[model samples]
Target: MTVAVTGIGVACGLGHGKTAFRKGLYEAPDIFSCLTREGRGPAEGEPPFIGVEMPEPSEVLAPRLARTASFSGRVALSVLQEAWQDGGLDDIDPERIGLVVGGSNLMSREQALAARDYSARLAYVPPRHAHMFLDTDICGLCASTFKIRGFAYSLGAASASGAVALIQAREAIRSGRVDVCIALGALQDLSAYDLHAMRSLGAMGSMRFSEQPGQACRPMDAARDGFIYGEACAALVLCRQDLAAAGKTYGRIAGVGLAVDGARGPEPNSAGQVRAAMTALVEAGLSASDIDYVNGHATGTPAGDDAECETYRTLGLEEARINATKSILGHGLSAAGAIETAAVFIQMKEGLLHPTRNLEKPLDSRFNWVRSEPAVHDIRRALKLSFGFGGMDAALVLEAPDSGGHTS
Candidate 1:
């Protein structure tokens, strides 16, 4: 079953929508800032760390909900609104639509802190309770706002949430469960408690301890210490060609594969990632030679980048033009893979591939890395990959619409 991605929307550290995100991908913007601790931020006296902040939404939601809305909810609403318009979902019946949302922990620090400090007494009033307490309430909120009443699901596969959500959404559409589906991932919590926990886990780059905000993340480079923590949200509308007869399409999702290392650790696993890639290739009915470019799951960490690189090498895709978008936009957690797939569209449409930034000394690899500046290449079929903390690995094959739509 083939699924076509008809529309794409993004709100991340790079900026909002396709234009800004594409510009950041190619030009490599110097976009990083310290986590704000004051209004609308985490707690006070928290350790300061540099991260990428998404720009304010181009169009704000209703003031009634905005006043008390969680950051992740706002981001999700904004991106989904853009995607709805982009996909022309108005043409389809509301009852025929479904949504699959991908996210990590998204809770308001103030609300959680209040509940923890003041007991369950502060749990509910009306809207506040709906946003956090209900597992599917967020999905329902988006459904109600979009008038999509078919079915809704929420999933968390850590950093691979975006990719896993897409895989599931595609299958849902293929199974004839819905005529249209929305697959998205977002993260917007800046709670000091969360940041402190992440940093203490040693998941962040050493540059956070210094003043090198511009040089914080160095994916696939020898000097890479760790990944920079950040937040973002990205969404896509999926449907079959018959449903979107005249709609615009970013690309056709040819195949997708998901796997786990079956081990408990944060280290990236080349074996698991390799299995996912090979499975995607088999499902797409294409060999390694059919892939023109690769968007890896590398997030500047030593073990993660090395494992991803080795995975590609083992899969016989080393010669494919490779890119590490985190080098430009930083890792956006759940939104990482979706936003990176959006970059694949720009690269294929414009025949240009973005390079990894700040790669002063690249690690030893046989793969052809696009470094320093944008490289012109005819990227027809690309592979976008993602890896999560729990050893979850995902890979998706995407091909240009004009690439014959041949899968088998």
Candidate 2:
């Protein structure tokens, strides 16, 4: 029951598709731009927050779907298109394909805009608003466009929604419910109110580097403040290893772990993170010494980064080379997990690990940190971590496609 990643597609500030994403990831990591009032940035009267916004994808939806679809839904469709074609899923039976969309309240910004625009003309609000407000709208749009009929649904686990969706999609295939599944990290599309709330809660970065947007997202750095918002949507196509086409597989999901603290809040729990990491290791039949690299869940926050560092130390994984993808891509909130997973696979294939941008000073110097520039390394096994608000933590162990082994 080995679940292999057959295809991946991404739309982020870096660019669209794997080629652009790969080039930007290594060569031009500092692409953060000022958040525009009209774009995916802060609205008027809100504190200035800098972040990365995705370039428009080449794929455009039909005029009919475009009129009613939310921005998040439209972006997701474009991303999914790449994965679908890459996976060669066009030949697969539509009834055997399933989809799992991560993140809830994905259309918050769209809904907020609609509310403000139609406040005085409530009666003239578009009828599509009825379905557009629901997070499942993304699942529906993707399913219809891609012809996935086995099953499709949306799941929310705070910021870990993407990783959790990946786990669920893996399970769907392992359980024989579907021959292939798509795990999509839907764009958060945070509204002005959402940004204000996150900043008020001290979970988001301040305006310290508002003028220097590139330095705003400093994950795992001593000078880091908080996570910067980014606009990104990524999709991964998972299927049974036997179903994967020759030379098309990216890697195999050797193991997965999910843990939740009993309490609810934004704070990180070292114990829960350790539990998740250890569980994933045990599931993968791997020990601390076997892990070569770690895709850390460092969100440029004080509490979050420290907790993750302690978790690695406690797990005796200090020797693993680790880097923060958020430093280069900014935090995609719900989309972080999938994008980072894709990054890990790309690095594994390319034999080079992308650098942690803005990491001038290491938060903790004990661990092996890939700082400032890309490093040449042949990664055989890599661990990816994702933690969300409300005590959600997830870990995944990915094995190189050429790695010979199978997990039950």
Best-performing candidate as measured by lDDT: 2
Top candidate (TM-score)? 2
What residue pairs clash in candidate 2, if any at all? none
Candidate 1: pairs in clash: none
| TM-score per model over all chains | 0.92, 0.97
TM-score of candidate 2 against the unseen true structure: 0.97
Candidate 1: segments with Cα more than 4 A from true spot: 37-47, 108-127, 133-135, 188-190
Model 1, C-alpha of 270: deviation from truth (Å):
0.9
Residue-wise lDDT of candidate 1 within 298-395, one digit each (tens)? 89888888887788778888679988888888888878877778778878888999978988777865678898989999888888999998889999
Compute the lDDT of residue 164 as modeled in candidate 2. Answer: 92
Indicate the residue-level lDDT of 242 in model 2: 90
Cα-based lDDT at residue 239, candidate 2? 95
Q: Give the local distance difference test score of model 2.
A: 0.89
Q: What's model 1's TM-score?
A: 0.92
